[model samples]
Target: MRAPLLCALLLLAGLQACVQAFYLPGVAPQDFKRKDVIYLKVNKLSSIKNQLPYEYYSLPYCRPEKIVQSAENLGEVLRGDRIENSLYQIQMRVDEQCKVLCRIDALSGAQTKAFKAKIEDDYRVNMILDNLPVAMVKMRKDEKSNSLVKLYERGFPVGFTATTSGGQPEVKFFLHNHLRFTILYHKDEITDLARIVGFEVEPFSVKHTYETPWDKVSPTLNTCNPGRATFVTHDMPPQPVKEGEEVIFTYDVRFVASDIRWASRWDTYLLMIDDQIHWFSIINSVMIVLFLTGMVAMIIVRTLHRDITKYNQLESGEDAQEETGWKLVHGDVFRPPANASLLATFVGTGVQLFGMAMVTMLFALLGFLSPANRGGLMTAMLMMFVFMGLFAGYFSARLYKSFRGEEWKKTTMRTALLFPGVCFGIFFCLNILIWGQKSSGAVPFGTLFALCFLWFGISVPLVFIGSYFGYKKPAPEDPVRTNKIPRQIPDQPWYMNPVFSCLVGGVLPFGAVFIELFFILTSMWLHQFYYLFGFLTLVFIILLVTCAEITIVLCYFQLCSEDYHWWWRAYFTSGSSALYLFAYSAFYFYSKLDITKTVPMLMYFGYMSMISIGFFCLTGTMGFYACYIFVRQIYGAVKID
Candidate 1:
């Protein structure tokens, strides 16, 4: 047990050292001279509704002569990111307007249907140039500015549906065929090196009127000609997407110099958005912590001290026997509850998850796991969880031994397999559903195999080794021996019932972090950036404190009620917060999102279920340990034989 803990500490230390000494840049910026070709990359077509991403070239859109896929990490693959070269060309520090790339005289029936379906689903085209994701600029009313202000939505929508004005409105599909790009760059004062900082595009649709006849090689357009160019305007009519209809692709790229530093260039693109809600969340959480702290302090300082003092003054064992409440049930208080195996496994898994979350947040806070690292954060989390298996097995084995369990092998296996197996099963089923939809969001078979290998190969071995040593290690000291026959818990009132108490106990912990949970979900599903790891870390610590304090309070009361079956109750009391988490997820789905598809809805619930389950383990473990310590100290200080 101590070995695994030492190894984990060492691993964490090394990781931190590596991050500080030799930090690897996720996407390094390159300085380009005048007229240098800057390659543009397209990521994928995404929609908030479906939540299923498709490869950008999946549709009959214009593509580069050679589509070269960019290298991706495990996280990127899991995220359904398919970054590839694009057809649109750009030159550093050069302006281009109304340059036509290709002309499609007629769209195939299949092409037309695909475009219409994508438009209906509200898909957005995500593009990347010089590491900055291109955003669609929209004008919105700003209260401070009496006029309209430009707002940057992360990705540009594919197209919109339109109805022509007539006696009977004719429904039609319009495509945004023209893009006006605004590339912001920063020039070094010393070296004159120019690095691209921001990329924003205004999408427009222009139904071109051609002046020169349709020639395979060259064509002149009255609406858009390179020599006498008519730049794309917002008021221009969108090109209709119908069978046997002509479509022209055009783009304009203009580069502007700025004084912003390369390091902070992402600040503008991160929000373009209020954080008073964040302040309120922090304050609310701090207040809850303080309240719980005060209650716990009162119990320790005023209540527990008096009880111990009075109990210590008892003349003999006969006087102690007359004592009521917790002192009467001291012998049974530390007895293991029903299904000790399950508790041990879940507690171990929870510790593993807790370690991963703490370290990941630390990395994010230190700026190592920036968005520029693409899939770095996810990859780090998965790796950390896998490596933390050592500690999981150690703790669970010790718990199993403490429960007087003999099947060390079986208990260790359960600790290694239970939580991850269930999570992986849910993920695999969801991946199959994604495959059925032909969505790129599905994890590849190779990646699935790798996940299995990590679980069975590396993680399983570490868990077994840790468990073997943990079983060899001595169990913790028990102040009093458990009676061979269990103590019968007295009939309790409705509010003191196990279920009711657990439910009530979970509320404060959930309340401490729901506001932050909302923001996390928004960032995950709504395609927004979340960089406030500091606030997240604070909330995380507060949540742990809340769970621990609340459980200790409830356990003290239960002991006072003379109910000795607190082992499972402590776990459930904190774990029930996952219930409210699922409830809030349902509420958020209906209220915050525009997802109308069946698969996406299923996905939302499925993913939320996994998160809730994980959270149950994390918080439950905190609570169990807290109660364990409280029981140990109180029982140890009392006169028990």
Candidate 2:
């Protein structure tokens, strides 16, 4: 019965690791069916660095017929599955005299008025205009394109340009200026009331340019080939009209699709992951792992065995006369440190973050949180953190009690607030800055309130409940008893000093993960796609092993030095990696990113601080627990009088 149950558990674990989320295949453009009509959906307008959502009239648009997929999950939807068609009417005609093509838009008064009002009232629109308008086009696989999958199915918006008719060509207005309106109001003499008179478009000839991927066949062709591409220059903008006036905004449209093939549209982003770079990173990490593993084996098999054997064989008279090394400090080894409450709080929070990270990665590895699902990763993390508050409170309360602390309520409250409070406060401040800039990246007031509700309403109560249960149980017993007076730590060599030891301990863990960290940063800041969770999971496991082994080895050395003050040292040794991480981020910003604006720079550092804080907690907890287990095991093995 036991064997069968164990086998079942093993089978379930194996299946979970290999599970993948399902993705529906995209339909061919020819086979795609539209629901009678299509509308040109407007997306947020962006500049080179910033983006903001705007209000515009939903113009009726045309597209090849196909069944558009509806968002089946929040992750899929957040990932940008909410493309909608518009209802604006349009007409196009060609003139024979100059061979100039024109687009005529026919919009109703009511629709036009509402659109204008939305544009004027929304500050986000003004912010967008301040930068410039870039219009995006959504493309899917064309059935005739002989590709297995769509490539570059979705991309950033292209810029629009309008030129003056004079010989010396100058841009009259950009697409950013084209959508703007200037209205005139009229006053009735009899009623002495003012009303909107009319609105008009400032006219100019328009042209648009797009950057295309290099063609595989004609790879050597110069990019300035007008003959090989369709040009829609010499087009006119809409004429100005009054408030009650009706006018058409026309665009003479011409599309020049590139020869770039897509075996799968999703593969476009993944193509940037160079195969050689990935292999190099993997091999580098493996080499670090082997070095650390060999060092740990030497300590456990050779050094530790020698120390234990020599200690056990000491005669009674010699043992009393020659008490030197770790055994001399046995009584004080379990002694609680100063500011026990603070250390306990940090440990509890670290445990919470560690648990949250592990669960999130596990879900992501199982395909429940794929990049295709959009905001799935962040959503999963937030939800997991809220639920994991129980563990945070429980561990904090338990550790505090073990330290003989009396202020259980205070410890619990601090556990619930400290790290999370700092993170949220920084986030809220940065959000205010984003809001002031009127960028679309700003979290809305409603979302902010919702986050607060999640933290206080859900997480706090769960933490309290866990704390209550934790206090009900007895505190953990120490493996060795504490002395009435703490043993004075002996002077240590310069290399074993806390600062030098922590700095050295952090190097190996950071080295193991820095290669993967570069890719992660690229995906976040460079707008590149990251879909390699399998590799990420492997790196995460390696990091854990590296952290545990390094901390254990360092703790042993400290013990041999007769330094029982390993509590804070153990935590800082692992947590110091976050400091290195921040330094690397600074290097990345200066060397890789082209950002120059004050707001973007502030935002970058603010978010990086939060990431570093979480990493510090996660690593610090691993180091502490590994040291705790090692200390207990080595002490228990010795036959103490």
Best candidate, lDDT: 1
The sequence of per-residue lDDT tens digits that candidate 2 reaches over residues 1-641 is 65335434543542342232233222221111212121233333323243223222222122224524333332333222233323321111111111112222343566445344333322122111111112122235445566554222123322233466769986421221123122222434465333322222222323322234523333222211245653323243333322443232222222122232322323443555665676687788888888878988898899888777877885779556776778778898888888889988999899889878888888877766544444567666776777677788888888888888988888888988888899999988987887687555667676677678868976776677677777768987887788898778878999999999999999888898998999999877765567788788788888888888889989888998999999999999988999999999999998987667788788889889999999888888888888888888888777777
lDDT of 1 at 61: 81
TM-score: model 1 vs. ground truth: 0.95
What lDDT would each prediction earn against the true structure? Answer: 0.85, 0.61
How many angstroms is residue 253 displaced in model 1 relative to the true structure, after the best TM-score fit?
Answer: 0.6
- Candidate 2, residue 358: Cα displacement in angstroms equals 1.6
Model 1 regions lying over 4 Å from their true place: 1-26, 138-151, 164-170, 215-218, 316-318
lDDT per residue for candidate 1 within 1-641, as digits (tens), equals 67567666756753653354223333777887778898888998999977999999888888777889887777778889999988888988888877677888789898899888898888999998887888876677766668886556888888888777978998788888888899999987687679988889888888977865776576777787667756667777769888888888888888888887788778766654346688899999999999999999999999999888887784777876678878888778878778988888998899889988987888788887776777777777887787778889889999999998998899899989999999999999999999999898999999999889878976787788778888889999788887888788888877899999999999999999999999999988988888888889999999999999999999999999999989999998988999999999999999999998888888889999999999999999999999999999988887754
TM-scores, all models, native as reference: 0.95, 0.71
